[model samples]
Target: MNFQINKDVLLNNLIVAQKALSNKTPNPALQGIKIEVFKDHLVIITSNSDIAIKLNVKDSSLDVKEEGSALIPGKYFIEIIRKLDALKCNLSIVADNMLRIEADRSDITLNMMDLEDYPELEFSEKIKSVKVNVRTLKTIIRQTAFATSSIENRPILTGVNFKIDANKLTAIATDSYRLSQKEIELQDTYEPMDIIIPGRSLEELTKILENNNEVVELHFDNSKILFKYGNIKFQSRLLEGNYPETSRLIPTELPIRIKFNKDSLATAIERASLLSSRDGNNAIVKLSVRPDNVIEITSNSPEIGKVLEEVYPVDQIVGSPIKIAFSSKYMMDALKIFNSTEITVNFTGEIRPFIIKGEYDPEMLQLILPVRTE
Candidate 1:
């Protein structure tokens, strides 16, 4: 392919497309990006079999010299574009399967992959699409994706479960130890869907979406899900299986409720966790509800030291006093999701899973299971 494009424009899209590049794949073409040059625009596609990204650069952004196609190594090609100091870069297929990049004082030629060997990514534009606000989608991922299981022992838990019922879209993620759930009211609804999206894919999608109020179009089939926004189309393969019914895990009645300042509680827990160790299975923080409407957070490490901090709740403590121990890391993860100044912690009992929720955001719930301590 031959084309003259603005350095920044090409670099920006390359950086985004690189998110889907497969590094360890045995297929040589899968490790590179396929560039298709048309009369009006250039298409860049990258995929690792599980996740794929296709970006379009309009003719207005580039000076098309010839209409052709080429497959360039994603890693080296992107690096060259990023390092180029010129405003515009010239790309040409100087020889069969060889691509050359020329900018101001720099000239480089890289061996290209065979386009025939590249995987054909089938994406239909006529598929059913759903519109969701970018900010809302980003918030949903940020709040719940972190709680997904990192290990693949249980493939379902490694993805975020998305359930669409009427106008509400609920996202839930859990590693059995803790769970994070967030719900968003959709502007329009047509059908209900229950699908599990890989956490790693959602995390990458979140990075591509803008933080503004624009809308993103979502399209999905039985196996793959597509997210289209601006000039980019991101597709991910859905995990097969039924996600665990997380609603039943939430307690119906939490008697011991404490509403504390979010910042105060987070800081106390962070300080307390300094003495605990994950390797020793002692990263536990004890929460003791005092009669004086104060909660004491304490952590003890036999090899290290101990820490104790008292935090007063914004609202008066309700129900009887109770003491519970949980993973400090889990508490910190839940706290980081809340932007509200005040948060509520609901405890069903000393051993049962407790929930942390923001006072202003009732749609989001964070649950942490208590850890056993002698």
Candidate 2:
């Protein structure tokens, strides 16, 4: 295979394909980026055990002399191309499974991996696929993927559950202590489907998606899911097991709802958590609505000191006065994701899970289970 292309164009696509390149896998082939040179375009594929990314490069700067395929070491290839000072880069297969890289006044040779060892990844898109705006897909992943459980004991909880019914698409993630859910309307819909996608995979996918009106077609089977963008295909393995029913967990009768400025609440929690020592669990902070309707955020540490921050609600507090203690980090995580200036924290009780919602962000809610402290 021989090709020459604009350095920037080649590097940009390679960087995206590098997301799926595995570093610690048993199969060394997984660490290489498979490059397929065609008559007019180039195909780049990278994969691990969980996620895979394929990119089709058809740029004006591309000059293909021959058509073939090679598995180049992903890390070294990307680094060499990135550091190249030339505007155009030339890559071709040399003798004895070695790849030669030539740029402005630079020469490099890299050992290519055996293509036979790389797993065959099928990125075929089904006729029945769901279309979602790039920005919307990115928003849902950003809002929900963080709540996925990091613990591997319950492997299913480490993924975001994606469910489609008609034109509505819902993404939900939970770590047992906190849950994040976002819902958006799709432009077109087909069959009903539900799948759990690893949170780590979704996070990696979002990094490649640009915020725009471009549509992403989603194709899925029982075992895996594929996301097709303009010229890129991202595929991830699905988790096996049923996700816990979480609709009932969000309290419907939230009698105590208080609206607060999202920034103010976030900063208040940050200040309160500052006094908490990290030797134990996450700092547990108390949020209380005083009789005077002032919101007070307090954190106490016996070995250190205490912090109290008072904030005014955006509007009058509803229902009776209440105080709830929860992990400061969880509340901060929920508050920072809101796009709205104002947010409401709704509660069913002090011990039960309370939800945070924003008026500007419709069909999305963040639920955090309160921490109990005597």
Candidate 3:
């Protein structure tokens, strides 16, 4: 392909596209970025089979000398564009599957892959779309994606479940030990959808969607989903199999509820976990709630001694006093997503899973299972 484009613009899009380029792909074409030069715009596509990203650059932003297409190696092509000191770069296809890049005083020639070898990824524009605020979507991803299971034993648990029913959209993720759920009210409602999106894909999608005010259009089928925002289109393959029903896992009534400062609780857990280790019991911490409105957090480690801290002046405590032990890491992960000043911890029993929620925000909930410490 032959085209003249600005160095900075090309470099930025290449960096985003490189997220989908896999170095270990058995297919050589999957390791490169497909550049398609059109009469009015240029399309850059990169995919590793699991995730694909396409960036469209309009001719108004570049000097399009000719219309052609080429599949250039992603790593080398991006590196050349980033290091070039010129304002504009000229790319032309040479003889015998060779590509030449000329910018300022730098000139580089690289072998290109066959365009026919790339996978066919065509997105339909006529499909139904869901419109969501960019900022809200990003928040949902940040709060829930971290809770997804890192292990692939249960592939479905490695994705964030998106459930759209009526006018509400809920996002939930869990690793069995801990869970995160966030809900948002939708302005317009359509057909209900329940889909499991891979957590790794959402993490990469967040990076490309930096603009908070812009809305994102979502299009999905039975096996794949597409996200269109601004000049970028991102698609990811959906995991097969039904996600476990998690709504029933949440307790309808938590008898023992304690309200405490969010920051204070998080700080106490962080300090108490220092002596605890992940080797055996996974840095266990004990929370003792007393009738006198005092909460004690303590951790004991044979190798590193012990730590004890008291969190007093709790806002309120209902039902009977309780003591629970849980993984310090899991508690901290659940606490980090809250932006509220005060948080409430609801406990059904010492052995039962407890729920954590912001004092004033009802849209987010985090659940943690207690560990048995004798």
Candidate 4:
């Protein structure tokens, strides 16, 4: 393949593709990126069986002298681009299917794999497309992805469950102890789509998004999901199995309602967790509300002593004073996604799950299972 591409575009695409290329794979082709130079565009693809990425740079961004394709080792090829100092780069196919990458005064020829040997990714353009604002997508991932179970043994729990119906779109993730669910209305009509997207894939997608205002395109078939944005396309294998029905798990009402400054509560919990780690278990934060809207947060460890943190509430509690203990780590995770000044923490009882939601934002809710303390 002989083509001249803008250095910045080529490098950016290469960098993103490199993230999906894993060297530990038994299949050698999995470690390489397939570069196909068509009549008017250059396509770069890489996959590790679970996730695949494709980047297309049109002829408008490149000056093509010839057309061909090759599979080159993703790591070394990316290194070549990184070391090159030029505004544009040239890639050529010579004898023996060898590939040459040239930039400025430095050029390197690397052996290429046969294009036919590379695995084919069947993308489904026919599947119903679910469009979401990039900002909302990012927010959903941030608020929930962190709670996804990291253990590979339970693959289903390692993904964020996405449910789309005619009216609302909900994304939920949980590690059993805590769960986060975010819901938003769909502005346009779309067929119902229920699927589990792996947390790792969503994390990568979140990082790769350039702007929040851009609309992200989501396409799903029975087995895979394709996320298309700008010049990049990301495909992730869908996790199989019916995601547990979580709607019934969320409480309908809470007897105790406490609203506190989001920043102040987050800071207090962070400071308390530092000293309360007596064992490997995270620190426990206890919350109680007084009649005058004074909410107190306390943390205690047998060896590390105890701390008392007090903050004023936006609203007063009408029910009996409720005492509840929760993992400081879990509370902090839920607080990070709340950008609002005041956040509501609702509780039914000491042992029941508590929920965090914004004053005006009912579309998002974070639930944390309380820790039993003697």
Best by lDDT: 2
| Displacement of the residue 334 alpha carbon in candidate 4, Å | 0.2
Taken over the whole model, the C-alpha lDDT of each candidate is 0.89, 0.92, 0.88, 0.84
lDDT of 1 at 138: 94
Per-residue lDDT tens digits for candidate 3, residues 87-175, read 88999999888999999898899988888999898865546788899998998999999999989999999999999998899999999
Better of 2 and 3 by lDDT: 2
Q: Return the TM-score for each candidate structure.
A: 0.97, 0.97, 0.96, 0.93
- Cα displacement (angstroms), candidate 2, residue 338, comes to 0.5
Number of clashes recorded per candidate = 0, 0, 0, 0
- lDDT preference between candidates 1 and 2, better one: 2
Question: How many pairs of residues in model 4 come into backbone collision?
Answer: 0
lDDT of 1 by residue, 112-222 (tens): 887889988976553667789999999999999999998878989999998899889999999999999998899997598999999999999998888999989889877
Ranking by lDDT: 2, 1, 3, 4
Q: Least lDDT summed over 10 consecutive residues: which range in candidate 4?
A: 274-283
**Cα lDDT tens digits for candidate 2, 1-374:** 99999999999999999899999999989999999999999999999999999999999999999899998988989999999999998999999999999998999899899999888889878888888889889999999999999999999999999998988899999999999999888877667989999999999999999989999988999999999998999999999999999999988899999999999989999999988644256888898988789999998888889998999999988999998889989999999899999999999998999999999999999999998877
